[model samples]
Target: MNTIWLGFSQKLLKVDRYIKKSFTYQAIEKTFAIILPFIIIGSLSMALSSSVFSKQGFFNQIYDISSWLPYEDVIKKVLEIINTVTMNFIAIMTAFLSAKYITRSFKKDEQIAGFTGAIGMLILNYNLASFTSDSNQETFLMQDLGIRGIFISLILGVFVGYIFKWFSPRNKQEKVDQYTFISRGVGGLLPLAIVLGILIGLTLLASMINQMGVNGLFYSLFRLTEIKSKHLIITILFLAFFNSILSGVGISGPLGIMQGGLDDTSIVSNLSYSLKHGTSFGVPFPISIHTIYDSFGSFGGTGMTMSLIIAILVASKNKNSRKIAKFSIIPSLVNINFPLMFGLPIILNPILMIPFIISPLVSMIIGYFFIYFKWMPPAVYNLPRTTPAPLMAFLGTNGHWSALFVSGIVLVVTVLIYIPFVKLNNQAALIDGGDLNEK
Candidate 1:
């Protein structure tokens, strides 16, 4: 009775902390990690497809069959080179920015301690991909955040460091200090502040520039989008997934090419094609849910759009996580998609295990139910995913409008499903008292 009573006591004491730690933050972060890669790719693909068709430019002949055979295969190679280069550049930016944000934001400790702790966790987070990948199960790094090597590194680094600080030797004396802001790592705090300022400032500068000129930004956007290699859904899911693993060791695409022998496998592409042409939406096969996006002519992606919403909604609810939340999402919305992914580490976390599986299943089930009930039309349309995905899906359905409504329904359902799990996990975390990262 006493032991049982103690267990109940612990549960009661930590319930609020659980809610604080989990919920919106985890879901959104997972959303960020997986979907951002596709957003970049899809946006790039749409840009290319649009340019090729409009101007008869480099990518204009994408539909031409001769290009992939002997003489024209070079076009494919060039496109491959461009994609690799772009992905690499992106990986670097995400790494540095993500690393700094996670470490600094969650630290809430002395400047160097939080920063160093964040850095320390970084290495472990990157390792999580290999740490979690399995043949039967989807990769542990999570599909929403493709090219996860960087995001995980950033996330784990921050998490571990903050945890470390929480366990800092100053426990007894420090707890007595009333105002935390005045505590600082006090002296080291200034440098930490400067580092954070610099990172934020640089990101803002980039955003302002991108937002300033619409046409130029659009053109740049087109060029980037046009740089895709083909069978986009697959590319986003598999190749992007593959890229995450390689990124951990700093071995990006060309770097892999330099290694000699190669193996080709693209599960996401095969799945994407099956989702579009192979399987009918009503079929019980799981991929039909993708048709949810397909209901619109322009909706080529389902994973990222929903992922972003999940991340945003989850992060907003968790007050402690907002520091990381606020900055990550804006840039994420634009094309550089890391803010949400690593900021929260939603993918492999045990707390989210239920929702990750449940949300997708529920979304597909509800989507199917709506279609069957005649409350919503079948998602038979096809279109590229660009700009904002969910909203685009709404327009592509020829204003089926119901798809948008359905998407909203799915988002709300996902949140409802994910909340309790997040709460349980967050409470576990607080009681366990954070990662080895500084508090």
Candidate 2:
């Protein structure tokens, strides 16, 4: 078993190196790196908004701040705007940065490529009906321009960047003069036109088909998981697997696709039933995706990343890994793991992939059994996504001690599962002679 594990780790390391060398992967990494600060700030704002400011927030539930806090409404509004620009527009920013980096990789006019990528994203999300209607109002589909659209944004950005690379001249090595600047601008015009034309054509085609665009189609596929069925566990596992894989590739999962648990039918029904029955003990969906995955599996964000952080801090000797884990702790406590995802870069790291995918599924299964056997009630309250992980099940079940205990047990099990993977990652780094403290 040891020999087999070692061989698999070696093969995984090779795959990791190969992926890191790819231009597209490099572009995605740099895009995430560049946008990480915004993600952190946005996460902080979201955490505060959900936990402190909102009437339904965790803190507000504990004690109503609005009754006496000065300028609470104004502060809440400011935070909302901040969250809107930083989080709601993340995909647009991703498009710009991704195209910039990809164009830079090909020595093309990166600034123009970045603009083109952003414009292309906008074009793809453009709704003709919004403009054509007589309401004298324009509506931008936030779903297509926000976290939900990241996968499409990255694809579009890469496409735009490559178009520039194919059509535009390589950047000059020498110092740029006015003539050179004009020449470069003129050279990019063709690529710019080509990319924008393609995007425009696609938009028009989507409109002609009476479709919202690629992202709309993508989410439509996701909505298929919402079908009610007797095979509840199968559906939950499918979602868990799909969400894990998408998140592994740096795309926002379905849970992150819609914040606040507002649109999820199962969550709504569970909450409604619990409220009506005055207890979560026998809610209709006692083992739903929300009751299991969101309540327990998603501790410290997707894949129960808090476990990863704990594993790193406890088992990793790599300075960089330890540093990242420390930095990620606070955010992870609030169920925000973007810093760790991009910084430790679980996105493309094959070494962590197994545990990253497995830990959450394991936790979800444990949670399912706990609720199934009546060891705890299902989490039925609609708490903020930013609520601390261990407390989520407890609060959602309206102070169920057994729910909290189950959550704690799940966290410990996931941490154990991740520890071995974290050690394997450290071993891989040592084998590669990589500087553990580098950057």
RMSD of each: 16.5, 3.7
TM-scores of the candidates in the order shown? 0.38, 0.86
Query: What does candidate 2's lDDT look like per residue over 394-419, in tens digits?
Result: 98899999988888898889999999
Candidate 1 C-alpha error for residue 436, in Å = 6.1
Write candidate 1's Cα lDDT for 1-439 as tens digits.
8788467546644553455465333323433454355434533433443333333432334354344435444544554455455443343334344434443444434334434534332322222224345645432212112242444434433443444345433433443345455554564454445444543454345445563122123223323432234533333234333333333222222212321221122224434543676432333322232343223211112223244345545644555445444544433332233333333444334444344434544565566567566675454334433234445335434457677898777666666665555555555656655443323
Task: Output the worst ten-in-a-row residue range by lDDT, candidate 1.
Answer: 293-302
lDDT value, residue 187 of candidate 2: 81
Off by over 4 Å in 1: 1-290, 293-320, 331-337, 435-439
lDDT of 2 at 104: 77
Global lDDT scores for all candidate models: 0.41, 0.78
